[model samples]
Target: MSDSLTLIEEMLGREARLFAASNVESDDRSHRTYIVADFEYQYHRSAHAGYQVAEGAAAEEKIRWPFHRIVAAAWTVLRFVPGQAVPEIEAPVVLTAETMDEKTMVTQFFDALAAMPQAIFATWGGEAKDLAALRRAAVEHDLCLPVQLLDLSPYSIRRLDLCNASSVMAASVHLPEYAAALAIPSKPSPRKEIGQLVENRQWDLVADQVAADVLTTCVIAIGHLKSMAVVTCDRPATIMALAEKAAETFPKSIFCSRSFRPWARDRLRAAGLRGTVFRAP
Candidate 1:
């Protein structure tokens, strides 16, 4: 194993020892783990594209993101002894407002989240509007919003911007610098002009671009951990296909593309995380 992997294993092993000591088990190790579910508003954009509801109505409605479902679903495939399961973690929720006035979308998310008794909602780029919306919605709705913040900025393995063309510009300028530091090739292309494309309202292209980001980001997020799940707002078909391919390539690694509802339950089962563990095996 690489030094990085070895160091990581040692850290996780230390934690596992503690975990096993606290539970009733022969070995102080568990297959269950936590992962950060990085939510992005994929369905929000889809609803706008399909005319299911006017953009105005969609903003007000508490619509679920499809990618959340995929994340939850993927959890069903993995199973292990449960004891405050340690293998799953999700990214902080990430949402982009289609319009400045649609801060209500953020509010709705937290309000719904607060309704859950025991919950962990992750976020990416959770500052500013995302955090603001969460606060406002949680307060106004009189809900208990339990959130553990996962900052994505510091640990960003790679970044893909789907909302606007600015991401292209940023990537073009930033990636080259990054590659040079790593002694890799630096290539620039006309597509680097993100501002212009966004101005043209190229929604499909935008989704495709962000989808690529979601895939890349999720892969990187899970790569470092011994066990993990990467929740995303990517379309189910796309996410599942990737996970399937990954499973084929890496038989030992478990990947799932499920929604939060079903997947969360699976997580509970696989991790044996229903309640607190008073003792370890």
Candidate 2:
């Protein structure tokens, strides 16, 4: 096999082992699945220019740049059976199409998610950016959005925006910053860099970066939902100090709820600690 193929196989193997060794219990009764995803898109500069022209060159230009096309998307789906300690983590899925067929890529990505059973889609800033852009793109392209993505109820748990959630709790909301604060590894590529790759028509590299973002988001969600510790303190400074210390002392095991939960049950198991070690606040 070519070296590139070998490397891909090795990476897949490593991810498989990581999932297999997770502290997965067989008691899952919720019968729900989770999809953690991220999307990368480019602005429609021409559309903006057209709007400016149509308004006779004097109308106030809309500052909100519409992401009318989806350049790339990546997601990781986890099947959570109620009562199970660890959900089944699927391999990362990435989609990046040629410029002419970008909408088709978006459709296919959503279609895959729609086909899944009882899935909940989660993203860090998806509500403000990714999902909104996707809905608009789907309409512009005359493609139908999956029901899972179309539901807009404020209380719906089917779609989760971690950034929004953090904002509600008045905590740090940026994904990369939050991940860093929680000791999750940084993204493989910077967000600004993806635009340059898109400009250069490097879809493969863009896909790779998006995949890394998706995986990082998935890990963060897992840590947030399953392993984060809730510590109560009278002073905000004390909370910050505790969070920093936990992240530094137990990069993989302990996570603070103040910055967002850092410790997952799997992390505790990996650290050879009992679940009871984390006391409820």
Candidate 3:
């Protein structure tokens, strides 16, 4: 493994072992794991063109889900263990490369998720957009998908669509709006710019945007869980503090790319965050 990946593994080491133990026998303690996922995709011109050429005037690929190709997929692990003030948020992880094709990128993204199928996969627009797009991409590439993701019901134990889970406050609002309600820092480059970034091979920016989405989804999930009493944790004030800590720690950090720092740090400073973020070796 690369040094960076090794570090991430180390960061997750204790939870990794505990997860193994939980499988063999229930510890009789309350614990849960969530993989907050999000991704950035570019509209596939080829698919658009194929529709245009085949149907002439009838072709309209300007806005279609199947034509969207995954460019960056990002996630962060949240370990909701007892005896902790709040869920332990893992360092945000992103899968993307400027040179990687959609096939390889989607493959790696699913491979990572397949490694932890039982973990609850949470997202803002996950059901309607992210996973749907993934399913289409897998078909296009003949890639094997984890059954955990393919047929997940919203109420299924394996998946939760924050976007649609709630009655009004959640399903009716957008991801950014929900995040703003929770006071989380979620602003990144506009979604419209993703295509140009891909065209310019600006994978870092795309990755950052996806990572920010993942983080926002995670924090919002925590907030939602707290409201539902599904997971117990610290008070609202304390949880918000830890969420900010995660914002500072990830997106732009000591161990990974800083391409996100200039944009993210300014928001941090505006929010009055100072000092370097400490990560254990």
Candidate 4:
């Protein structure tokens, strides 16, 4: 196999192993749900532009700082799940309720997703409009979506967003800075605005993002099975908040790609682990 393929496989393998080993049981005796995930999308086009700042040194600093808090919220929720009756661990669900224009589709999609208790996830590209539509959809469908929503603006909150992880992973292989860090190839330069580059219309990029996000969610669930706490979110502020809280309670909270690393080294170490890693096999 080519070196490129080999390297990709290696990175994937390492990540899988790390996630597999993360399974540990919490002190509670309730049945562990492993993982529960939700997706966020912006309804106002202006809000979508904020994510564009995610390109340079600005992007790195932006992500490195406050985003921990956003991830922390997800952690906070997961930490308390034993006391609450979270929705069943159904098949994964995806929602795209970013604007009023998408009302018809969002309504239909919400109906379909609500029926799938095993899995449900969704995304939107605007802020107020998108969130409003989602609220309506939830109410109309007799579901509740009153949880905290992730807003990418204000630059104060940080979200450990995985929406761009596949691109980052793919680009790291070829870009000089990320390539060297990841020990991979540099990507060819692109000739489009950041907005244009991330247009969902580019089906290929969208698919990669969705796959990466879903995989991250699954890995997180596996960790939950081990009794380790799991947190998730789509906005930087929420992630930063979650991570910050986790850091206080756990010793080694780490934020990389879209998911997080265990903070406590001693809590329920390796409790529900089925294997040493996760893969399609």
Q: Which candidate is the best by TM-score?
A: 3
lDDT of 3 by residue, 49-76 (tens): 8789989888774668888888888777
Off by over 4 Å in 4: 1-35, 38-43, 46-101, 112-133, 136-195, 229-281
Q: What TM-score goes with each of the models? A: 0.31, 0.66, 0.72, 0.29
**What's the lDDT for all of these models?**
0.33, 0.60, 0.68, 0.32
Residues 1-281, candidate 2: write the lDDT tens digits: 69999778756754553344231212333455678888777767787777778987685565353735677877767665454445555655667766546677777777776565246788887877777787778778877666556567743556777777666757646677887776564455666677788878887677666765665576656555553331111222222233343344334321122222333333434456545555443
Candidate 4 lDDT over residue span 1-281, tens digit each: 69899778756754553343233222333433222333322234343346545553444332221111110001112322343323223333333322222444444443443332222132211132334445544455544332122233412111222223324345322123432353221112231321243344443332223323333344333323333233332222322333334334433212222233232221123323455633231
Q: Output the better candidate (1/2) by lDDT.
A: 2
Q: Where does candidate 3 clash, by residue pair? A: none
Model 2 weakest 10-residue run by lDDT: 230-239
| Deviation of model 4 at 46, angstroms | 8.0
Q: Rank the candidates by TM-score, best first.
A: 3, 2, 1, 4
* Candidate 1 minimal-lDDT segment of 10 residues: 67-76
Looking at candidate 4, the ten consecutive residues that score lowest on lDDT are: 67-76
lDDT of 1 by residue, 1-281 (tens): 69899778756754654344335223423443222222223233554445544564545444333211111101111112234222232322223333322234444453443232123232233332343444444455444333322223422222222111123335433433433453222222123543333445443343233333333333333332322333322232322344454334334322122322233233334444456534321
The superposed Cα distance between candidate 3 and the true structure at residue 2, in angstroms, equals 36
Cα shift from native, residue 55, model 1 (Å): 33
